[model samples]
Target chain A: MATNIVWHEASVSKEDRREKNDHGSFCLWFTGLSGSGKSTLANALAKYLFEANVQTYVLDGDNVRHGLNKDLGFTDEDRKENIRRIGEVSKLFVDGGQIVVTAFISPFREDRQQVRDILNENEFFEIYVNCSLDECEKRDPKGLYKKARNNEIKHFTGIDSPYEAPVNPELVVNTESQSIQESVKTIVQFLEEKGLIKSGISNGI
Target chain B: MATNIVWHEASVSKEDRREKNDHGSFCLWFTGLSGSGKSTLANALAKYLFEANVQTYVLDGDNVRHGLNKDLGFTDEDRKENIRRIGEVSKLFVDGGQIVVTAFISPFREDRQQVRDILNENEFFEIYVNCSLDECEKRDPKGLYKKARNNEIKHFTGIDSPYEAPVNPELVVNTESQSIQESVKTIVQFLEEKGLIKSGISNGI
Candidate 1:
């Protein structure tokens, strides 16, 4: 049945918000196996950007799975679907003129590429939290690796499933060796060099 | 089952990004029906913010449905899921210390409230794009109203489904009575009043 009501209408354009924020929006995607320190680096980078007075946000995998993606399981298809949803969300963030950092296992190459395709060129920076599987198991912050090794967990990346390393990442943080300070410095330097942060350097960092 | 590996820590924090960007990260959500001028406003807002040197991005409904929300259909579950994913993504953007403007129909009040809950109290700004149904029908740029009238589409908000009006919005823009110039001015004025923009008003406007 047709109704005479016209419901779709909203005001405020994208250009206006972008002008107010001062920096171009993009997604910083961090991919690695469980316990690879993707969350740690992403959080630190976000902090650095925050101090610099840049608009920013982070998507931690554990937090998301607990809420927005709660219904999703660990099956390969489910994981792909999960990444797909995150990708779309990331795209929205980019549109809003904010730097978006996503920390996820995102073990599939195709899925990561799919996310990149959704945004503008050079907006999606792939940061591989490069840590050996053995290293990640050693620092199992959530004990996920232990459960995976014990067969209590199924389809765990780097245990039963695969983690496709980035062939060419914009940045690769070797979490196994560098101190947190040094890692953050590298990320901050990258943002500064990219001109993402203009004027001051200590507002949102 | 736990192995040890060196972890690289970051020196900086999100505080630094905020200091540099000169503004806090948050979500500027634009809600209305399709062709209600949401995308147009969102895009223009991004542009304006960019010109003012504010970090920004825009998330339009059509653009998102084409990619991140592509796998899902138009069922209620899918719609909820879509908004949920967007909430998560906006959180990430705010974490990155960037401003975000999202334009979507976002028909239901509950769903919109869910997105607001995902954000910090002051971080979410609900900008209701207020336009009467009659004017919206006249501005049916996509001819969607025509399709709905012919029963070519189902579950369309304002046609077959219901649109829960926003009870309290941060800002309301009546696109019908206001010219794009006036509408943009209203938004810029809001940002200025909120201390988001530092540059002077656009002479062009």
Candidate 2:
């Protein structure tokens, strides 16, 4: 079916969009166990970048599941498809000249690697949000651990299911030790040091 | 798996991004048969809007299928899923504060309505690229019509399958009769008249 289709090139390329936005575009993929503060950190970073006039967007698990991945379930295959779709969407956002941040548990190394393979060099950054399963269970911000313990929810990451930590991520932020503000600062500092954003932006104040 | 998930609200919302970009965000869905100039018109409009300093993006069939919808095929169910996924992605672009244009065959009214139902009023504007099958086949930019006629392709819209035109589209630009420049001007004028975009932008010249 795709053989007959021809690619119609866009007049406004990613480089042009980046030049207009005054910043580089890339995807920041945050993976970790539940309650590890991936969503919190991603949102905080989005706010900081927006305040600094850097074009950015965050794709968290909840918001994405409600729309693009609504039809998917919690099977291992579905989980892989979920992360794959998110990676593709993030690629589109990057092409549109925005720093796209995605937060998900993403419990498999192979799935994460598949996402990375779809992106260009330096276009995908794996951010490992590190927190122990014990800490995550203790937090239980959404009472998910309790349900998983009660056998009410199956395939729960860090509970019944496995979470394969990143082997060599671009950055590692331990939410158990660092505050949300500190985590956001570390990420922003990394982006600036990598020349993703302008060097002198007051660190988002 | 989703029970433990909590929605983290973004500090910078679509409204804030729109304000920063100095324009509103909406989707211009271009629907018609293959070779009907949907991609051409959508790209023209995107370039015009981009030159006018209006944040814009075009989501076309070939590019999207090569990435996000690559797993899908041309079956009826797959076609519905394809449009559904595109609709979801376009919603994301709209949420990111961009005037997103989508080009797809999208031959079913019910499927198109499903997409329209997902968006709020004034957020989705369907543009019907009206062109006769004869004209489109004669043009045959991708030689798809020839393949379809030779029975090499099955379930091809307007040949082996059906194409349900929009009953009441926001606008209909007949590519057979109108120049691409005229078609773009009509659509842009409609956008301005509907206050979807700011007027007095010099037609992006």
Candidate 3:
């Protein structure tokens, strides 16, 4: 069946997209516990990049679960499938010549690794949103920790399920201590240093 | 569990993205049978849109099945799931302020309607790549038609399975008669006329 599938060569390649957008395309995969500021940081970075005339988009647990992965649940297998789909979608965005930022708890190391392996060497940047369980629980931005404590939610990362920290992530933002602005600065600085974007007068807050 | 999920509002909205791109964001969904020139026409439009400085991306069966929808097969259930996922992904691109063109066989009207229902009225443009099966078989761009005739493939659209055409598609490109350039010009003219794109000196051939 696979043999019957023919490859259609796209006249416009990723290089063409990048040349048009004036920046390289890649995925910024943010993995961490709930309330670790993954969504916040990802959105902040997206705004920064967008203002800089860089094509950018954000995919997070909230927006994704409501749409593409709506049928998926919180089971371990479902979680893996969720991340897998997001990885593939991110690849598409990168291929379209846009910077895609994805935020998910993504609790397992192998699951995150699978997403990274699907992209080219420099196309996937795994940014571990590092925060202690205590800090995340304290932030309790969505009251998820309270729900987990009350036994209302099962397999909650950092409470019931485990979150395997990235052994060697491309970048680590310690959101527990760093301000959101600082986190955005760190990421934008890395992007500039890597030549993903041409350095300009910083528009990032 | 649902109560624990809070929507994080981004500083950037779809309007912001559109303003930055200097064009409106929407999905140009091309539906037809295999060998109907959907991919060809979609890529042509994408190239045309890209050259116009409008952020555009093409999502077709070949590239999508190889990645995001890799797990899906040609089964009825899988096909429905495939289109559902594509609709959601297209929404993401539209939200990011891009004109996304998707080329899929998407033979089921209900499935196509499901995708249309997911987007705003004007945001989803259903383009029927109209071509008779006999014409497609004659073209036989991928030689799949021969295999289908030999019964080497199961549930081959227009061969064994049914293809429910769109009852009231936004536009129809009769690829059987119209050239690829003509098809692209028709679609681009529609976009410009609908004010989906700002009119410029037509670069289309």
Which candidate leads in DockQ?
2
Model 1 C-alpha lDDT per residue in residues B119-203, reported as the tens digit of each score: 8877899998888877777888899988988999888888888878799999999888886656767886787678765535443
- Write out the backbone clash pairs for model 2: none
Better of 1 and 2 by TM-score: 2
Shift of residue A95 alpha carbon in model 1, Å: 5.7
Assess each prediction's global lDDT (C-alpha) against the native.
0.74, 0.87, 0.87
Candidate 2 residue-wise lDDT at A73? 95
Candidate 1 is scored at a TM of: 0.75
Docking category for candidate 2? acceptable
Per residue, candidate 3 scores C-alpha lDDT tens digits across B38-118 of 998999888767777778899987679999999999888999999999999999999889999999999999998999999
Off-target runs (Cα >4 Å) in candidate 3 are A1-10, A201-204, B1-10, B201-203
Could you list the chain B TM-scores for each candidate?
0.90, 0.93, 0.93
Clashing pairs in 3: none
Return the TM-score for each candidate structure: 0.75, 0.94, 0.94
- lDDT for B177 in candidate 1 is 82
DockQ scores of all models, one per candidate: 0.14, 0.27, 0.23
For candidate 1, the TM-score of chain A alone relative to the native chain A: 0.88
